[model samples]
Target: MNASRKLTLAAAALALTVGGGLAVSSASAEPAAASRSLVTTTAWAKVAANGQILGGQGITGINKFGIGRYNIGTAAGLNGCALLGTINTNGGNDPGPGSSSILVGQVNGNTLFIRTATPSAAGSAAVDSDRPFSITVVCP
Candidate 1:
């Protein structure tokens, strides 16, 4: 993994996440959810038909069916609203529809989907590589 790939959250937010705690004030406790920003990309590690990593490219946007957030690593933010998970599939790779890529962050909370695309340099697979790939999360 990229060591420099640090999340851009502030110290308080980082602490809240690490401590598995939530700071919901009376105002935040009201019937409402925060407007979360999704962090999705289409540049992921390339995987084989059996879900093996062959190579990869840069990520782009969130998947078309990015849903819900999961707490695979943190607990301070929304219960199902963070983009922190990993998925192991490419768009239209299965017989039906999902690649079944897993993700982090809780669903319906602050979750986000990250889709990656293959690089143009990878020959033969380049066409297939340009497809959308899903990422669940690689929690920090």
Candidate 2:
């Protein structure tokens, strides 16, 4: 058997033994029902520099208005939600010299306005720049 399969079986055996039972069955088991609501209360998006969505959950659409300026649509209202954003370096790869910053804000109940900027060559001020970023919104 494969290593993963063996490990899974071993873990199951250990759980059964610890629970005071040692029965082995081949039938598929149904998952237990959750005790609380399963509705999603959070949304996330990973957008490329060109405004294309790489991958995410609960994202509806994305629009690029100008360099480093984007509007991301979400599947739910964000009236009282908290926003968090960060620069994404393409799967942990080095982004090279200089650093980028992100600003996230709400445009409406379900829309988010995102802006990205980097330090100017002279380090005097920040200038709008195209950079990949990820954002998450949590609603209560």
Best by TM-score: 2
Model 1, 1-140: lDDT tens digits are 33222322243367677885444443433223567765543233443333333554333223333122211212223333224333343554532232233323334433332333333334454322223233333322
For each candidate, what is the lDDT? Answer: 0.35, 0.80
Model 1 spans > 4 angstroms off = 1-43, 57-92, 97-101, 105-133, 136-140
Clashes of each: 51, 0
- Expressed as tens digits, the lDDT of each residue in 90-134 for candidate 2 is 766524348778999999999999999876433433477778999
Clashes of 1: 51
RMSD of each: 19.2, 11.3
Model 1: worst 10 consecutive residues (lDDT sum): 66-75
lDDT of 2 at 121: 31
Model 1 Cα displacement at 69 (Å)? 17
